[model samples]
Target: MSAELSGTEPNRTEPNGAELNGAQLDLALAELGEGSERWASTTLAARADLLARTGACVAAEAKRWVTAASRAKGLHKSSPLIGEEWLTGPYGVLTSLTALRRTLRAIDGGHSTLASRRFGRAPDGRVTVAVLPLNRYDGLLLHGFRAEAWLRPGVTAAQARDRAGLGQLTPTTNGGVGLVLGAGNISSIAPLDVLYELVAHNRVSILKLNPTFDGLLPVYRAAFAPLIEAGLLRIVTGGADVGGYLAHHPGISHVHITGSAATHDAIVFGGSRTDAPRFTKPISSELGGVSPIIVLPGRWSARDLRYQAEHVATMRLHNGGYNCIAGQVLVLSATWPQKAAFLEAVAVALAAAPTRRAWYPGSDGRMRAARTAYPAARLLPGGRLLVAVADSATPAASWSTDDILTTEYFAPVLGVVELQGSGQAYLDAAVETVNRDFLGTLGANILGLPSSIRRLGPGFEQAMARLRYGTIAINAWTGVGFLSAAAPWGAFPGHTMDNVQSGIGVVHNALLLDDVERTVVRGPFRPFPRSIAHGEWALLPKPPWFVSARSGALTARLLTEFAARPSARKLPRILAAAFRA
Candidate 1:
């Protein structure tokens, strides 16, 4: 990958990014290499204990973690938008740690981690491992939300269990110094990558923070002090040059980065160093791409239209649309009777959502490109766009050619593409369109009602099987897959160095399952009071993740605390804050 990542233009994004020099970088890598053997040979029980202490440290630093992230991303301490910081920052990390610790404990106890997890068979005969509702705590914390991993075709549950914990059989032999070039946008990404390298691969890691997140180093250092103190991890900070050097250092046996495809190519192909790799190392990544959200035609209630509209809005605007999994393209059936009405509600909901700065680097240039592509694009409050489709009902619509449709905008830009069909025809066409035209394979989402899904039946699952994406979500934002540690988050498996669409490999898979084809996440169509009237009985209200959520900060704060240290006594207050949102 290139030494620098996307959103690197500090003149536009933020002014807080930091950097490290050559001497310190050299020392950090050496230190990490020195601990590689010890960390790899650490007993499973001790590893579990390390993660347990990590959780405590994270809990202790949770407030400062969110606060630092808030300031870095342009949110004031009092901004309710701090909730996004809380959830994506400290809360996500704690949950990942909690899951990893459980996996370690399970392996140490000589028990199957999947024994208590749910599993099912897709219509195509592939085994699917249920990833969410991971426990009573998760069930209550994220009521009505669920996710499952659809293993590679023909994989059985037995095969899945047999293949997991690849390095566990002989951890000492797997010891290596993994260099982690962290992502700039999400605060949790850096630490999450560190955890994956250590827990899943038995590697001591040297984490070189993205320049964009340099200011949050202190919070990260405090939260991960156990690993740092134990010599299993080293934290460094810098921009492109630093990362470039670290990625190629002699002591580094492997490298993993979460950035752009440009960065991935530069490193793998020797950017500015004769179009070839100067050093060989196993490198992995989770590069952002043009993710799609498919909405099948359904007989929906007025509340369904409104709530789903808000859901779509949240998907586009969350974290001010810097997220890799945020819904970039909206795929819909042009023949659906509710098309115009739904579009209208989406526009209204988008405008009604709270405003946040276009905080990422190069946003101005990207927004300009979007404006040039769609001259009629409506410029909403926060440089957001409700892009127009040139032909609202056609497979050959030229609107899909815009860079906004093909490239990862990494800003608040949503392009609506309508396919001409209804029912099963619409489903098949939508899947084909995305598979053929979308630029990346990281994630895709399908939104429809239970009745419509039931109507499609086997056809529905078959459609999901046909779509090629790493993580597929039904009636939910794919971002949830990124947060859930049990689900593997990365590009769809088969990509070579020549054409690394979303980069290669997976991370944050706490269960450590291999042979994963894609993870499917589902959520309630309606929330709370409306859900009860509709007999959908899922307890979700306006979820705190929604950008418009009123009590998001308070709710996420409570949720973060509970995740760090779950207690039955804390459930009532957490639920109160959640429902209040």
Candidate 2:
């Protein structure tokens, strides 16, 4: 039964792991170990069929899935805030499955889907593949947003297509079992990792659920029954002890984790650097870091300041500020005449945003630490903490030395840092500051008006090319990149295990392109109605992801159903809901 529809939710409990004893754990791992080889040889047709069936299962469980996740985050069934859970939880998973299924079906039909899409060359001649607007639905829903997965330097278009779907055409003949240490913050990440391991890498997987997400274990089990029934995957729940056991177990051939750098190091070196013990099995991770929301200075009116200010607030406060990519640092131009006004508007917007429970464990402690670090920290009406730093020509060194600038506070705590310049000079300096000072390489966002962006011209492109972050969003939150299945999500490449800033490798590259460097997603500065007046053609208004959207709950629900089984008939209601927003 649909909890939201029935006005009833399941009996809930505090987050607790379902830890297995040594024998039971060994049995589960052994089953996956034995099934790995068989999975490697599974025909593409069989794999596609499994994905198809899994989509059906996910749709069947979508309502319960979103309901449990919503209540877990302290949202009542009728609260508008439940919309966040719907979009990021089951909707994210369903859309990913839909995209992957399309990719596989294309491969089975003897064609590379990437080859059929529009491709462009960067200023440096690197190939950039469009990931969004995959069809009319994308074009209609996300209207103005477009994303491109930029390939690394020297990757030719033909070679890019040639390297895609690595193990699909010719399956791997190796014996392997993969361990995925799933992220706790987002409900979709764990299952998405399992799908990537099975379909992209040809490895059977054991997914270890983070204890914070223990409540959703049953939901995941129901949605991913296809893999479980096939013996290609095992889902387990436990604290750090069991995760360590699985990571160190010799039978686990490879490991993929979406977690913190400390956890990754502890697993690889067994928490001891004195002996220099190295556990060498293949490992890839998507560890998050302190992401900056860089705001470029522009001549603007009160409306523009308030609009962008609300956008800034949304960038930080979305998901109750629990997302890995939530913007932490607000980078502004010290010389811009409107800097103070913009800051004031941001304060008002944050204060006015609706309050939600600080649901994530330890969020209160984290916010307390941040407040303690900066005496200037002040709590807004909605309990959002904003800490302001003094302007400087080089704020990176002085600010970076402080823990507030270097740390990833996964809470509703945003800090403001002003750099000394404007226009092209400011753009270059801002990019340099975030790249040099920020702790993680996960994501960064830049916002600029049409006029300012046009004036900067090539300097903007050059700056984007130099940004070392994994995902870059221009006038959009990087969370957009995270939700897009076609976009490659992870840290920028070339981090060593010893200095794993944001960890290594990428996931969610449904195009299956090799040597992916980063994902660049761009969006209009304003939404529809306003966008029309501003000459930006985006048809969306107050996107469903926005916490302020009036129709977010219903629109998100429609999007989930549309992804599960899209139809032309469904577009009208989705659009109607969005237009109301």
Candidate 3:
């Protein structure tokens, strides 16, 4: 019944859509369509003001918003994972809003300014723009991490500079309505998707909340009140029929979704073989894929082995391994002497990590399928991490040919496949393997020692250039690219609706670059102070994102607040909260 009571329940009933039928859906779309033209013509100053107001509103409701998310996901009030709710919920939404507002303000002043520095050109002629170290604060917080977005080839620096704010550069009088099918897993996905539609495409949007998290409709409404008042956005909740009606509605001009490829196919080509198409509107999506992590052969010290093992474990176990960008497959050098040792280290790290609630929908079925497919798969004691090692000799075996490579488990299972080779040979073959065998082209990771990287030299850069994924992280999780608002996050630039690998297009591109190909994020081989890996750094506490941390919620809250309004006075408290973990 009440919102407060709903939070305490482990699971809430899905909202019924019996009343969200044809007439109501038609009226909503009509209103959105009418408002789109006004939104398109609205002054940049006004748009910036609206976004600023929305960001403030989100910050004010941060606590209540995270509480609702944590409760629905069965996280205890004191659970460390409550920090995840904060990070992925209001914090994400506010960040996007603030970034968009800043961009708008810059554009309004007759010049577009982006926090991007050109990092030379790739072998393929694509210009690489390093977009991280976005500001002084980011440089301080992220330290050695840097993210770069590579533009499509044939576009000159002049052209990119001119097209930085394409939405503002090319204003159209004929704007239309867009339908956003929100995601269920992450609390911020829905609102952020809506923001993209409004800011990037100049479209007014009606966001249909997923049935799994429809209970937060009130929170979304409050945060987006300004947009709702301006008639540029609307938030609604309903089931399958509502989605069907909205998708096929004639008044809707475009559709955007953040869900599975199956859902996207069903919307575009109808649910069954015999049925006709349900929606002919232009559709875009950000779907899940079996992301892979390639580890090159190198001479790693004991500390390197342990640190990287923990890093890989963190990538796999974050958010209970429900993230779309989670590392699903581990590609290793079969001939490397330390292959077995590395695998053992990874298993040890995973086992030592804390267990998390399997709160995502269909997690049980997915985990069961993984286990059945690989009968010998090792299930860690807590039933959280599943490790399946494929036989390198039997390339045709079920373990190699099974759904593990093709399907996104969407659970805490990391499949390991070892390939033959050692140095440059290994890197070349590994890149080819991931390009051809990986399920989707959304995100990928490559982990190699600094010496190994330098030894490969041009070969290493060439290997990175050859990867087809939209986002590639070297010595880091691809999730970093997703969080960088300046970096475009999507599948590779070219994908038709017929064979959409990791959905159709990009989002979170605050610079509004239309010709983005992919984003590459590189982090240090080891963190600062070298000995920090052994828990010796005073300034940098264990990452609050680690599931094993105890003060995750408090740390997340402090971080969000600091990002919203940076102050030297608050750094001490933030570090204190982090150390408390």
Highest-lDDT candidate: 2
State which candidate, 1 or 3, has the greater lDDT: 1
Q: What's the CA error at residue 330 for candidate 3, in Å?
A: 0.8
Each prediction's Cα RMSD?
3.3, 5.7, 5.0
**TM-score, each model?**
0.94, 0.95, 0.92
lDDT of 1 by residue, 167-232 (tens): 664566656888898888999998999998888788889887887787888888889999999888
Q: Residues 1-581, candidate 3, lDDT per residue (tens digit)? A: 32111211122233543355456666777777778878877888998998988888888778888888877778788767788888788877776787788788877888755534555687678787767766666676666678888888887777777788866665554548888999888898888888888888888899989877877877888878889888898777766666766776667789898988877776776654334444557888999798899998888888788878888887888877889898988899878888888988888888877676788889999888888877888878667545556646856344545587889888889888878778998888888877787788999999987777888898888888899999999988887787776778888867766676789888888777768889999877666556354333323445666666678789889878876666889887887787776
Tens-digit lDDT track of model 2 for 1-581: 22211212123222453436656767877888778867776777777788889999999999999888887788888877777877888888888888888888888888996867888887688899999877778998899999998899999999888888766756656447889999988888888888887778888888988877778888888899988988888888766766777776777889999988877777777666535538688788888899999998988878888888888888899889988898898999888899889989999988887788998888999988888888678788877998886577554557766675688888998888888878888888888888887888999999988778888888789899999999999989999999898888999999877778887888887877788989999998888777776668998888888777778899999999999999999999999998887
RMSD of 2: 5.7
TM-score of 2: 0.95
lDDT values for all models: 0.83, 0.83, 0.78
| Candidate 2 C-alpha error for residue 129, in Å | 0.6
What are the clashing pairs of model 1?
1-263, 1-264, 1-267, 2-263, 3-240
- How high is the lDDT of residue 413 in model 2? 87
Worst lDDT run of 10 residues, candidate 3, spans 3-12
Please report the TM-score between candidate 1 and the true structure: 0.94
Q: For model 3, which pairs clash?
A: none
